[model samples]
Target: METKKHALLSASSSHKWLNHGPIALLEAMVPEEESSEAAEQGTAAHAMAEHFLKLKLNQASVLEDSIYHDEDMERYCQDYANFVVEHKESLGENTLLFIEQRLDFSPYVPEGFGTGDAVLISDKILHLIDFKYGRYYVNPENNTQLLLYALGALNLVDSIYDIEEVRMTIYQPRIGNVSTWTMDTGPILEWANGELKVKAMQAYKGEGNLEYGDWLGMTKIKAISKDRAKHHLELRKYQLREAHLLNDEEMAEVLSHVDDLVRWGKDVKEFAQKQAVENDKHYPGFKLVEGRSSRRYVNVKSVEQRAAEQGIQDIYQHSLLPLTKLESKLGKEKFHDIFGDLITKPLGEPTLVSESDGRPEIVKHDVNADFK
Candidate 1:
């Protein structure tokens, strides 16, 4: 039997288990969600990046697929490969680079292991670069996932090289985020001995109680523990029903849980739909039905011919080519030379978020100030 992708104590999900160690035990009972198209695309992107970084040019260009292959993917993967190679070269000829390196960190976390996208070991520093193809910007500061990968890489190479520090990079080219963080091996080992080992043990033996928080955002815990999610959200409704108004602090407290509750509700609905469609799983009071469909011409060329016969010479749509398509055709230099002056970006509508969110808080303004 194969080891499950949702390892009880996987490095990728250290953030979740570290948040609440007992959630892993609860998570094991829940079936894994089917991979989404976005995830499949990310896999394809990673494969492309790996090929470019590990193979010669003749071999790298063979990733031909209509479904996920496109100009943007090729460009991004090439950029990632270039970044990794250039960085490795900067470290000198003695630096060894490994692609898709499997690492084990069981010394710290019981049964903990994961694959690092790329790892470079030099004289004193071991740099681990992870290629993130998703649009979500991953920061490298104190990220438990990256920290765990760093530990695993150090464990793999420390015996061979005298590594002093572990440096990790998160390259998310889709959002143009290349974030890096570094820590000395001594502190990393200290953390591994302290918080990491404690959480891993607690999670492995199923020893802690599940609590409600934003960590629920990770594993769709709502599917298995719908009652718990509902109960947690019930406080918001109970507070709303009370015959008194909430002040700033109380409202803020209630608002904190609303986002997670909404996400959980949506996940539950979608999970049921996927189960029904993919696995033939049935849900009471929720029969699957076809959605409304739109009509389209089956033979567009025949339709064009028929329209032309009816004296409809202009029975066609005309619109400017998308900026990206035009740019690719004209090349970046020519495209910018001609249309750079014509582009404008309007301010986006404001969105509410947690105080801990990295984006700068939106400043308030008065409508009358512009006229004044």
Candidate 2:
């Protein structure tokens, strides 16, 4: 028997491959991307949360500190801890807690696995909590990623514990959104056995309706492939064919389709550029261009010494006001009373924006009308 080294269908990326099977095969071939700074911070926050929970669970005397501590992260972790405390009574006496626990759902999906940030197994209910440091709102209900994690958790403790129901919670404390979804083990398992299984098998085989969807993972992979390029070429041909004046309704219809095509084109181009930079590959008639650089003082002391020798004591000093800090020092009302008269609205450069954008639309006015 050949043992699989990696999970073909990871729970975190279930949203993508499930919707479009070919993305799974494509991602399996491509090199993994480097984590962004925000992702790194989120990892650190998770570590801090786990450490804090461990101390709390053990009833330790002193508090352990984290070097990667941030004010927002600390506040978020505290919120998660508080939630656990609130539900402690319902959790029962034989409550078992786990942090960053690896969960396997191999029976449901082929080599499917995920890590739960916090798992609490009790008599009849299992509570799975996930901490999201991202700014986007994450609803626990109908969230494929969290549901997959729930399945993984069930696989781990369903046999050992009398878990009839599961509670899935998403804590996005930065946004002050705590969403919870509770369901019986029957429905969850049913989903796993049904849609999840079909998709996983189809994705694993790399054969199915492989089309782009709203899922970011699917979009990102498709954006860097020849499939997207072919679509782009077809779109351009159609665009030229329909480049004519139209009625208001026709214009709206055209824009509805054109907007999506334009966005996809932009995203695909950007992805290709990033891939080129990473792999040291070049497109014909185009080469990698170095980003603009700025000079910085390596030795501040040496610069200061040189300035002092030149009889300039305040050479390194500049008079600049940090208005926001001053506003914080003074109350908002008081700050406004003092500086409100000086405030002015300047005309900004015009740009197109989607209707969904919350910013007030720029309304043009005729200066000639005032003269008239």
Candidate 3:
């Protein structure tokens, strides 16, 4: 039998659509492909991690080669395995580990389900570990996805095991982060019954207040809710008329609300472009054209040799220092050992961003004073 695919209110996107119920309806209208090539590669890496875990579990398994297989994947998987081994005591005696485990939280939601990367079940605690191969930091604290997974796993094993506290972990080895959030079963269930159930019903039925918020749940829908469309139009009009004329304080105040509209515009543009190419949708005046490309040396060794023969002193002109390329040349461990504490990342230039952006804001201690 084939497995069930993710529902519209899938646990992974609960953090978004749960916060803003209307996005679920909007998302249903537009066709969406898998997010990106990075998502596809993440899936492949997940399969690799599953295979590795199963092998360690004494199951018949074999390592498979995939386009996504690389040093990062290998390192991340190994680190995940190490975490599992190191946490054996916490898992209690005679613990069993499940890989690529399907968990269902449909009791609270209409069609809520998610797959956990690793589920360590024991008498005392149920550890729900998720592997994130992406460079972005995924915190486990107050993470709806992890909480949903924990709830589902608890529901599944409530009868069999005397599980008490649930440990939700996000293992992002690429960023050297392993965050764990623990909560007792009583509170987790309380949250599901209170906040999760209410929000989920609102999203599932698509009947709730429709207002633009700081949540990252905007979708590409031309004729969305009448109220929402009217508000967006007004905001756009306001932006065009008086945005540039605003003082610093006024600009900052306006930005908090206007950022959502700006992001929605970007989402709409992206959606139109994707639809035109992927589904061959026709636009009145726009035609799909080949994207711009840049020339690159196919064989760097040959190019270097030819350059040396031609007496070119600088084969690589206008080059910038890239840490990845440097690590590739010198080997990561060796490069780190040599440049230890010598290389430092400078403070990035301040830029306005939406509140939904997960990156920590640079809290400046020193500020330039000037007349307003």
Candidate 4:
């Protein structure tokens, strides 16, 4: 049994094989004591199964609510298990073949692999399908995991089937979508060899450290340069004062330079703030609206309302301002010109309502009324 640390430290190429096997291989890498504790508490998969059973029996509605514990994982496991149980017949035939059948491909490839999911062989073609439970978008066709399974199947059946093309499909039931991609073994193998060669070189150079060395080096350089510039500015100010002693022209020149510097600094600060707002609009988080309480689930509708209230005119009702329109109107420079004053103002507490307030007071102003 490989230790968890050792398993993780192994090459990324090995992940293809390890990930294809039972989840238990990775599970065993965890400490026995920890695994025992998890088993005693009821594994997340068990909880998910219980949840699904309840939903099926009671016809309960599952809400898109926040979860602090392992609810998400449990739900995913339950869904997959439910799918398997519900579609047993369609899946049973392929599942049996997957479990029992072994193909020989020594003629074309020296090594082969096995897959856990359903496999279909038809008309001199082989297809591999794997399901993912997560909500994030994953392109099924180009996925390396699916590709690895295809490669293994290709090796086993190529001799008997005369396989010309391999088709890999990733079925994401959570999102109700399937992505399929085809791969030609020859070109793929060549690309794989090239990537492996680069990995070997990186390993040899001791450049495989996971720590972000490039970012750290850049951060250090930036800090030192900023400190040097600050010191230089202070020294320059002192020298300017000394040189301006009894010299009116030099004093005027120094004052003008200082004014320009102050103006430039303000302009840069405004530009940066506007750029931040534009960037924030593109972030996925902006599409997620937080509930009044931290424990509550996020609501997309609330996010849309909040975004609209922020003066973001969504012409297409897409909840987000289109990038092209944003660039034309709310780009960094124009953003500050339009919203700088509003951005700088403090959001004061809301005024309290009293019984005497009755109907809300309305203030109306008109040039004709004033003139009359």
Question: Predicted candidate 4: what Cα RMSD to the true structure?
Answer: 21.3
Candidate 2 stretches greater than 4 Å from native:
1-6, 59-68, 214-222, 230-234, 238-280, 289-291, 295-298, 317-372
Any runs in candidate 3 off by more than 4 Å, and if so which?
A: 217-232, 235-245, 253-265, 274-322, 328-331, 338-347, 350-372
User: With candidate 1 superimposed using the best TM-score fit, by how many Å does residue 308's alpha carbon deviate from the native?
Assistant: 6.5
Each model's lDDT comes to 0.82, 0.74, 0.77, 0.46
Error of 2 at 32 (Å): 1.7
- State which candidate, 2 or 4, has the greater lDDT: 2
Task: Identify the candidate with maximal TM-score.
Answer: 1
Order the candidates by lDDT, highest first: 1, 3, 2, 4
* TM-scores, all models, native as reference: 0.79, 0.77, 0.75, 0.33
lDDT of 4 by residue, 1-372 (tens): 642332221221333222222222332343332244434333333345444644654545343422322434555556654554444345344332242133322122223233335455654456665555555567764565555556557666656666566667665654766667877666656645565334433433334433211121222122222332353255364464454463666555455345334544554444344445655534334343443855553887786788788977653434656544553455545766775565554655555443344556544578798777
Q: What is candidate 3's lDDT per residue for 31-129, written digit by digit as tens?
A: 555567888888888887777666655678787677767665776786677777567646666887877888899999887888988898988798988
lDDT of candidate 3 at residue 356, scale 0 to 100: 66
Name the candidate that leads on lDDT. 1
Q: How does model 3 fare in lDDT?
A: 0.77
Clashing pairs in 3: none
Give a tens-digit lDDT track for model 1, residues 31-150. Answer: 766789999999999988988886632344456564776677788888998999888989999998878888888899887889999899999989999999888778899998888888
